[model samples]
Target: MKIRCRSAVFAAMMLLLVLAPGVSRAGYDYVDISNPFLRKIPIAVPQFKSFSGTPEEMKRARSSSQLLAETLAFTGYFKILDPASFLFDPQKDGIVAPRINFKNWTTVGAELLITGGLVQTAGLVEMELRLYDTFKEKLLLGKRYKGALADQRRIIRRFCSEVIYKLTGHRGIFGSKIAFVSTTSGNKEIYTCDFDGYRPHKFTNNRSINLTPMWSSDGKWIAYTSYAKGNPDLYIKNVREKRGTVVARKGINISPCWVPGRFELSATLSFTGDQEIYLLTGRGKIIKKLTNNRGIDVSASWSPDGKKMAFVSKRSGTPQIYIKDIVTGRVRRLTYEGKHNTQPNWSPKGDRIAYTAIADGEINIRVIGVDGNGLIQLTEGQGDNESPSWSPDGSLIVFSTNREGPSRLYVMTSYGTDQRRLLEMPGEQSEPNWSPNIEGP
Candidate 1:
């Protein structure tokens, strides 16, 4: 298969060298930190300085600064300092290292600070960002980024990823994207947005019903089910190229799940009169059938090691989650508490599987251990919560809820704390799939 290159509106020029001036303590390792006991870091982010001598430059600088602050706060690790309480005005203060007042920030209860300067020249914008450890009074990380004036969000997110990497050993998911199904345009279509729900744009304009947007293991392609040709057919679309190829089959092709670290996928097909799961290549060539049950079987989620799969089956006369071993073909029932349980998402860390279960006449999110022990319920009284998808790092889960009004996407930690809505849009959003962190240049 030929890979298609997707071009953005702006080009990024990232500097290779990063300057860290003084000795800094080893930051918190999130991999070792448990979700329930982790504490948020206190940090301050002031408005970026403007040097372009134009009103538009000043406005852009302020927006970029706020964007950076929000991105950092969204990580669930940082407590952003309010700008109204700052002792020194970031707009009036100098942004260079020599002119920074560490005491001013430290007195305001900021353990860390981020300051940057933005300048727009011709059609391009140049940004210089520096992260500071106020207690130590030393520069922790600094970078120079250049891009189009319209691409300020991307530039800021790039720097934020660097800051996360310097503080935590792993890079942040700032560059990762979310694929979802939305009904904003009077029809169900696949749409995508940034990790923070910005830059939302439609991926498929087929003007037909689309469902279950799943990203490939490599994040290059998105597989979804579309009813454009009168039947539910599976389609693989190159996200950058904005084109799709249908996986032609006899019957319904729905609920496609990619095998970890491979070019093949497992999906539910109704070619044999009843829905069953089958394994296929990236090009939709049938490799083998995984489920041979007479009842309806769908929604396949691959384990991290590719040794097992968790899926929804009705073989017991009710929808429930079941795990199947790929080699031995041994099927084990995982959920017996909920009357209707479905949409099992295997965690990327290989510890737990998150799914949606109906209990007390409401649909809620639940998680169970891989060994069928330690079952925990995440959501209780919010609304009808369904379609729980785990983040690439397995630290957070993004699901949809209709509690407030229309259905909107929400993100919560893996332990079911900090439940916050992700985006507020016009249409109903569902089936959120987080992409793997795509490395930026």
Candidate 2:
């Protein structure tokens, strides 16, 4: 009997190995780059040159160049170069001989290169962009646009989308903003700003800590946690509004997340003495209880279909993420390799859940499949990267990292690449909520 049991276990392990390449791997890292199938290659980006434009127009070009570099870098395949690291200046034809030496560029470890410049034409400014294949010594993309000096942001963003297509076969999300919480001001407050930390707006004025901020389907309203009235309370505020409404009851109203496919919310409320995940209607009424008692069930994340939920609980002693069906109340454990796990945020397409797994009490976010497979850790050696929110397109994830000092915003791909600091506001911020791509006001 014992031999048969061991044989069955070995067979199961072999089957899992064949099904999930990264699951049960020895080491945990942001990406499982073991099964390399000609994954996207890296590229080098240099700042674009600007000439014959207004002082303000020149500044806009420079800023647009930075944003464009950032957008390509976010795609996870580009090994972006720092503009300061470039020994060669970015100049156009007649300015730097117009002939780029491919050998010089390829020697610098650049597989692909991008070049562009902005010039003043009439009362408007003209932006010209060119992407090159250093190996082929040919231009991959070339385009020019004419727009007002102040339209630099949109024009450059269009140019960036072209860059991403030239490399990753897709467009990039560069003009998006993430709403989250910050505690650097001695207390946590709700804030929403640009993806690159340009224009920040404070949402909550109370001197209390906030957590679990979730963006509305429309990307305008922000639902979050506040202790303003004592005990954790769930409050929803419009990004542009004169007031906010209490969505849930007081006392342990933790981790409210937006429910996909509908205007409802799924949250963990502990009013019954122990935490349990609940599905609340859009109007703040309890539609159903998703979990029973016996454990501290929290951190409920809804799949894109809103049919299933992923959450963490103390049912396994420490904490482990669990998935449950909203219809039949059937439950399943989603993590076994990690001893400590929490905060499971479902992917936009519902393929995986990104959660925090504590290694010796230090927390780092990791990703896993919906059926407790493909456990891939996304951060290595960190202060904390607790809550991870996926972009509407499932291409990017914005989370908080304390590795580099105070907790600030960081954005990376679903496969984890090109990690970059996203915000440096006046206060500590975390629990990022990446909204859907809604048209700006």
Candidate 3:
């Protein structure tokens, strides 16, 4: 695909020299620590134990172990062991003292084991967990994570994340959610789903066009571009409170992203003389001017640190990705590998940036380092793969592709494995953005 850049080649070169130092490296913050090529290890989880409370009072005690197993297994790691087939009773000490039979677990090709116990004291719940290395016959990580009975699931998610971190030294995204634009009915709407593409429940029932949804760092609200009243407008949706509000109702205000520190949001508003990026406080106060280019400069995504920004610019004649320094207000193009690259989505870890590339008239999702190196193409030969969204852990990308049939949600590994389609089918979905599952947004 051929990309048309309005900025002259000479002009782009000159801009690079003067603006290179000014471009803030503050925009993308998701760190790339996971190795996609490594094979996942086998693991075992004996249902977590309980000491004081009844099985029912333990809340997630009975299912917490299974949930952890499934969560780790779905991540392409830890082939879990089935307790029914094991020699030991998984729930033996589940309601009391828990002990693991290492030999029994090793007999079934298990390398790692995870055990825990739930204890309720004076109407409060507390939990203890232990991870063991079967071969070494020693405890790998044994620590007690205590939380209220109401927070057992929360404790489980955190413990599971800790296990992943101890094993790979990289944070896990098992508890994250993906935010995307789904058109289930005749009208386009915004929806939220798990990172694995499961439990895709709709959040917006408005009969309007909403696109480019972004989550705040706090994960309390979601900012999206909607055209309910008429022209494209920006709206914020809170997950827990189940509240939605219009941030920008007039002009072509789109690509709303929250700046770090929760000070304000950075968005593009055409209400100005032309389309340019601006920073607005949480209360909708314009704080600063981000871009001054006469060309189409929009889609500003903040780096994890909130210092620099990565946005799509036509200043180079064709649409290409560029990184700008916030301190001095200079810019440099990050993508020169493909033409017509747009929709630069920054990962939470601040490691990789996913975008759409036009090749032979086909749009395929691709990823590259923020420095414009280590370019890797994830989708090839699909109908048209666009809107590459990163899982909060930077493990996979949920994108929409018109493959085999119509435009449906397709989830792929960050390194492009298990290219599976989500949903049974029958509608058009596009522009997926994954959110950290801390709160709502």
Candidate 4:
């Protein structure tokens, strides 16, 4: 079979440098993310100015403003203020710092404000965006971007990343992708979508049973188990090059997980008469056997620092989560309450691991500390929630759930709050693997 891959070469947007650095009083400490009961910052984003005043410009103006609001709100950090409640207008009033009125924004209990102006030409758009501290009455961030009109979302996302970093001291998850298994094409094939579930398209079209799409650490490759041939073999394909290698061992090759900051990965191979995890190179060469247990040992999840791995083992009578020190070869059980626990995913922060457990005939998601202390359920009584994957920033967890109906992708805060559906499509989706942030804008 031939794999078709299309790659986009993004030209850097022209940046108009007119921002003053030390004008705003607010600093990086604006939002304390560590707070369990963090308050959502109220932000007012009025309609962007249509400098051309043409119908096309006006249409994009409204859509772009709404997209900006939605993008920021998706971070679970901001509350978008209604446009009807705004006292100032983008058309009549000024968007610049000199001709702005901060009291109008602060009066409506908005601590932050974002204003934009857009101009469109034949095929390109030029936008100027500004973020302000309403109480301090100063410009916090300002930038001008020029790009194709179709690239409006990317331009807005770049600005949003800057907005988040200015406030949170960390770049937000704006350009990441999530890969999962879906039956949309009448078979269990691999599909991918943008971080917020936009632009979902099939990643694999083999019309076979493709499962567990795992992204490499560099976001350049994806390793998955495919029954395209006869047996369950591991296929590692470079997402951009359209070429790959196959690890068709003797019995079975499954559960491929990449090591952090390296070209190596670990997968469970049953070729040795017993299922065990083995570390392999990116090109599919066995480096060493990672486990030598009598029972089945699979589903390897690596810690952020690559010092430890958390996997599922049936060595303790029932399937449970276990952590292994890569250096010392010391293994310890992490979960004991559940009879069936699997699909362990280590958080990027290296503090917790999320896994799926079947309790009372119900499958749900749970998070446990690295030291096996704090065990809390993230989803319950909601239909089966399985395959929990953490975002690169460690702020959110994406998992597949059947709470409403057929299994679909859902995302929630790390603490399991603000649970919401990620996307809707024709068929069921499961086993989502989130990619790291793409290289550039």
lDDT of 3 by residue, 357-416 (tens): 998888888888988889988888878998887776667778888886677888777888
Q: Candidate 1 residues 14-40, lDDT tens each?
A: 333455544354454523456522667
Score every model by TM-score: 0.90, 0.78, 0.76, 0.95
Which residue segments of model 4 deviate by more than 4 Å? 1-8, 16-18, 22-25
Model 1 stretches astray by more than 4 angstroms: 1-12, 21-32, 51-55, 91-99, 242-244, 439-441
**Which lDDT tens digits does candidate 2 get at residues 1-441?**
111112211122110011112222112221224421125554666666777655765675677678777666555656676556555665443212247777767877776777767776544556677666777676666666655554556566666665554444444455567788877577878777766566778767888777767887766667788788887878766666645567556458777777775767877887777777887775567887888868788888888888888888888798888888878779888888768888888887688899877887778889998877788988887677778888776777888888887788898778776577887766677888887765421
- lDDT of residue 63 for candidate 1: 91
User: Which candidate, 3 or 4, has the higher TM-score?
Assistant: 4
Residue 288 in candidate 1, Cα distance off native in Å: 0.4
Error of 2 at 408 (Å): 3.0
TM-score of 3: 0.76
Of the candidates numbered 2 and 4, which has the greater lDDT value? 4
Root-mean-square deviation per candidate: 4.1, 14.1, 13.7, 4.3
CA lDDT scores, all candidates in order: 0.84, 0.69, 0.71, 0.88
Better of 1 and 2 by lDDT: 1
